[model samples]
Target: MASMSDHELYPIGDAARRSGLSVSAVRFYADAGLIEPTRLNEAGHRMYDIQAIARLELVRTLRELDTDLAEIRRLLDGGTTLHDLLTTHLGIVERQERTLRARRAVLRTLIKQGGTTAQADLMHKLVSMTDEERERTIDDFWTEVGANLDVPDGFVDRLRAMRPVLPADPTAAQLEAWIELADLVSDPAFRGAVRTYLRDTYAAPEARTLATEPFQEFMHGSGAALMEELLAAHRAGESPLSGRVQRTVTLFLEAVTALSGTPLTAEARDRMADGYRQIPGILRQLDEEDAAAGGPGYGDTHGRYLALVAAINGTTGQEHDPIPYVWIADAMQAVQPA
Candidate 1:
């Protein structure tokens, strides 16, 4: 149906020149089925009509955009839409960008912290966790702590609620906090402390004596009473060695006695007071955890747990103020055995 002029076709060289591509590129596209030549001259040369010239230009443009030949062919054949291709590629680009950003932050933080290998390893581990992975880390800690124990209903949920949900784009400080928290939860000493708290709170049925009530009620009463007393002492600036502050040791002992479901003897009181001496040490650990977490956000998950347990057990001593604990212990030691 072509007239003589209409059948005029460009050779591969002319087509490549018009499309700003090399002759080899045009030949490659043709061989790749991306370009269908209008005809083959008798001399065995590929010839392109106006339509073929336009297709060659499209192939050249797609190649410049980094589109693979097969994908370009799919686009040209209308087998795939430009929108779908770009959308899928865009998602991939965004994810790569996010990963790059995280890596950038990790390196930056590592350098600022003196570029130590240990720091780099730790930060890299923290950076590798996805949001879900971070959540699982917290869950795993609680799981380990709660294993083989009669954890009260809602206790694990409360602990989960305290978990810090690290931001998708975290700051250096947040990263530091996350790193510290992750390390803390993995510590054997920390896990043992948590287990000890759980054991004391939920005394095993076989181990139960007449000295204790239900764990929750005891925790609430003991926590409320101890907190009220300590916060008042804290507010009043009472010296731990003062007689007035020391006398409150009896109140503390009574609360412990009420929970233990046993008679409050001088020896039992002394042992309980000895246990209270550990409060200052534990508080020091919590303070370190808090400091690492950049001073509290999800309220220091470990700190919250310890504070709750301490309050319930009537040993709510401030980390920096060991006076109350010292006073209580001294007072208990002074009491004569009947």
Candidate 2:
């Protein structure tokens, strides 16, 4: 604790040299209000005491570490401690590293996609969306695709289950699948196809609510029988239109009619076949995209939705493996009267 009068002061040039900073750099920091001098020399030159020398050294070190000027100013003003600033800086650095890693992942996806600039741009957007924003994308999709349609019981819950929640640190493959899924849902043709399928599946709001119970009943009863007959036919090497196949197809169509509470006319059955056909195609497309991106295939949304609906209707054991819907539809078509 030297007396005020005994404390030595150095001019800016000497201070800069002692701190290993250039004179211009010292002037810049002083002018930026980052460093304050103890007094001005008679000629109006800046003069700093020992405390200022220590502060200037710290300022220079912080600048070397690329700390923001405002942050440094706060630190010097005693508004924040060095530990606080460093902790915040570490968070910023980590976020920057995450962004760089995401960019690298996007580059790899672009290369795998054959360097398509449009796809690269799309992938970049996918990676950049915040979690809330990504969730909104799914909401928007369901809104557009399910518009004015008769959604089954717990439809929203099923949609939520199918939602893609991208990980905070997504891999290249995950990003790629995200981009593809975003593209698929954004397509007008895709939306229209899903809309028509949904409309045909549940023709009215009343039917939508009633669909789960009868559907579960059919699935548990006649649906199981049809599947057994089909499997038996497959094992016997019989064509889908063979007498045995036609019998089971008739039984299946009758079961569908009973569930619908409507006449099982030719046109109605055609619509049913077409509706079932749409889902497997969509599922196949997602599966192909996931495979190309090296992702585990899209989680089984089609089956899961069905299972959820059955569960809500108090149906269990519906998880038993059964004949593919497409195979059933094809057999139904094959057995249709000329």
Candidate 3:
């Protein structure tokens, strides 16, 4: 209090220069009670000490960050801590960042897909759906497929359970996958084709039945692992008739029959081999037909749907060589011990 000579103050112009704010902005903040003059000069003009200049700088910074005037006012009034304000603001920034990424993904996909009005409208609709709505869309697809069918219990649930999950921060591929998958399931033609396939195949009265849970579990679990093993063997130039490949195929067949509650009989072997033999022709027919020329082939739609699911789920291993499978089919059909 006795060191009056140590006190220094500058006028409004100097305060604005020091704080990097326009004089009007400084004055506006002052009027808004965000910052005020440390004292009045002898001429009754506003003057600021060093502390007031620092406070003015803080106000300028907050305004630059898009903090509302009232929020800045609260901060200046000591209603909240700077730490808390910044923490909450950081979260807001992160959410905005995610939103921007998603928008970027959509825009890129739109460009890649030719950007027609129809495509744009589809993107808008897909992006506009809430997570629950998207989930409901998938549920509706599975429900309609299994409706009035004699499929096993949890059959519809099994179909619905492969829901594509879009991450919080999605890649461009994932967003594109979601767009395609959602559009596919929403299509009445696709739904009808898949439903017909299900009705004719699994829902048929004489269809061989497998327990839904065990079959799915084994397929996705051990069956997947075994396929990987077979793929590795194939890559290593092992013949389908090689000891390793044959042994792995044998174990796989045994496991499948066990899961289905059936014995791996010679007749079962013939049926399975016949089934594999038919795949290439079926795939070729589906591939040859133009999807736009007629209703979608059940197999083609299912494959495309799975490819999109793989993209969305960020999984791999879709590639295969039919040659190895053909050899395997021959091995299965050959005269062998049961």
User: By TM-score, who's the top model here?
Assistant: 3
Candidate 2 residue lDDT tens string, 178-296:
66566656767655655555565467664575457556556656787777878778767777778888888877776777665876678877876776667678767867776686533
Q: Candidates' TM-scores?
A: 0.41, 0.40, 0.70
Instruction: Select the stronger candidate by TM-score from 2 and 3.
Output: 3
Comparing 1 and 3 by lDDT, which wins? 3
**lDDT measured at residue 103 in model 2 versus the true structure, 0 to 100:** 85
Q: Write the per-residue lDDT of candidate 1 for residues 1-338, one digit (tens) a residue.
A: 76775667988888889888999988888887888788999998899887788878877766766678778878889999978877766777777766776677677766666678887777788778888887787788888877875655666555555566655555444555566566667777676666665565447553343223354455556655664665477568766556655556566666666665776787787787786677688668856775785544224345655444344233446434334665556656665433
Per-residue lDDT tens digits of candidate 3, residues 17-128?
9999999988988887778888887899998988899889888888788888888878888999999888888898888876676677678888877788887777877866
RMSD, one per candidate, in order: 13.5, 13.9, 5.3
Q: By summed lDDT, which 10 consecutive residues of candidate 2 come out lowest?
A: 296-305
Segments in model 3 whose C-alpha atoms lie over 4 Å from true places: 1-14, 39-50, 94-130, 149-154, 166-180, 197-217, 236-247, 257-278, 289-293, 298-300, 310-324, 327-338
How many clashing pairs in candidate 2? Answer: 0
Q: What lDDT, from 0 to 1, does candidate 3 have?
A: 0.76
